[model samples]
Target: MSKTDHPHTHQTHAAIIKRLKRAEGHLRSIVAMIENERACVDIAQQLHAVEKAVCQAKRTLIQDHIDHCLEDSVGALGRGERVPLDEFKQITKYL
Candidate 1:
């Protein structure tokens, strides 16, 4: 489903996008460093930073989806309704 169709909005969408962009820039710099024959330690450090940023962005997005979309969807269910255990397990895999 599209973001607009989700029951809850992502408050960190903008921040996530910003983080991804920064990661993208970092990746480009790493590529340039490789072409310029930069020191291995410097390249590794930059690569590490890029990986960490991308990881953080992914984590933030997943947490936002769980906290908002999943919670909101389940909260809307009628009193007698039940969410499948398998579905809960599936969602938790992202965490």
Candidate 2:
């Protein structure tokens, strides 16, 4: 989706990108730390940050799917537009 749709869209995208960029830096630092044999605590914290970033991205994707995909599905079904009910049901099942 375009960034102009809704505030949630832009905000979520921004959060996701920022998290990934930070995680990228963290990954580089992780490699350096590994080479230097840094403390395990610091490494673990960086790993957790990566995990959180992944989850945040997942949540944002799910939100967009719900907002756009489900909305389109519902509208199509309501209008009896040619979208097969069984197929739509399967699609909605994922949501």
Worst 10 residues of 1 by lDDT: 78-87
lDDT of 2 by residue, 1-95 (tens): 44223333444677778877888888888889889999999998988888777777767766765665666667777998655445445445544
The residue-by-residue lDDT of candidate 1 on 55-80, one tens digit each, is: 89888977777766666456645444
Estimate every model's Cα lDDT from 0 to 1.
Answer: 0.77, 0.69
**In each prediction, how many residue pairs overlap at the backbone (N, C-alpha, C within less than 3 A)?**
0, 0
lDDT of residue 43 for candidate 1:
100
**Who wins the TM-score comparison?**
1
- Give candidate 2's error at residue 76 in angstroms: 2.6
Q: Which regions in candidate 1 have their CA more than 4 angstroms from the true location?
A: 1-9, 76-88
